[model samples]
Target: MRFSAGFSRAAAIAGLVGFGVLIWAAVISPARDWATSNKVALQTSRVEAARLDASIQRLEQEKAALGIETEFSDIWQARQIGEATAKVQAELGEIARAEGISLRSIAPLQSPDIPFAQAVAFRVEAEATLDRVVALTSAVEFHSPVLIIDRASLRRLTRPGRISPQPTLLMQLEIMAPVFIGEGEP
Candidate 1:
């Protein structure tokens, strides 16, 4: 249809006003509520971000010290008190045999697996020269696998009647190492 310029101008103005009212009703009014919702959401996100940042900082600090603390915690599960004791004795025997030292006995001591620290001890009796005793201690110190010796003592024993009495050496020792839970374990 064809219209006059004056009427078309009035119709266009009316249409514009109607469009503005619709825009204000649908968008502007709801935008206020949305601004409130967004404020709450933003606050929640900031709290979560702060928490995550704190956690990351803590983990990074631990990682810097030990390289990887949580990953190595599994060592506790792999450690066995009895197994470690046997390994110590067996290794001592091997070293003693190689050094021509005779192993007489081992008085195994108490082992208690506490959460932060654990300990195992053995009182070993052997007969060897002073040099051999030192060598055994060095070997155990350097060559032991997943084991540690907290203390060791060597004593020289005297023979009563022998013309040339070779010295009998004895050792008292303590060992400590990490203990952990196995995979998929509590």
Candidate 2:
């Protein structure tokens, strides 16, 4: 039997179309899906890297601030224990005089043994009004050198014959000054 030319041509065209569809299903479709997933992963990684960079900048700023505070504290440190105590006493006397407070006594106490530094303590007794005492305490706190008020006591003074308008208070303060030991010192 002889086949028609039109029928053979149509069969060949259908075979070519079927082969093209098979190749697309086997290779090209899976490759396209993989490329799409990799693009999404790249975007996510970029976002994470930006967030980490911002956090690093913030930490650096905090470290710089801490360094400045440390330097400021170091500038106020004293070298010798006895000299620090005497200087603290003189400063207290000056503050009392300026605030119109009468300083009864200023005596040094036993120094405390601290690591890398010595703490020189003092017992200060003064008589003044409440306002004057408050002013004196403020002066000590805001002074250039670092002065710590370890303990404070205020009591009303009683007089037998003399009746005054404003009551006088006896203020007792325990102040500490830190003296840093240098490398060259013994």
TM-score for candidate 1: 0.47
Candidate 2 global CA lDDT score: 0.78
**1-186 per-residue lDDT for model 2 (tens digits):** 246677777778887887888888888888888889999999999999999999999999988876673433532344565666667778878888999887899999888665545778889998888788889999887776677788999999998997877788999999877666444432
* Per-prediction TM-score: 0.47, 0.55
**Residue-by-residue lDDT tens digits, candidate 1, 118-171:** 555566667676777777677666653445566777676777785434455666
> What's the distance in Å from true for residue 118, model 2?
2.7
Per-model RMSD to reference:
14.4, 8.0
Which residue runs of candidate 1 sit more than 4 Å off their true CA positions? 1-63, 67-81, 112-119, 160-168, 177-186
Best by lDDT: 2
Best-fitting candidate, measured by TM-score? 2
Q: Candidate 1: global Cα-lDDT? A: 0.66
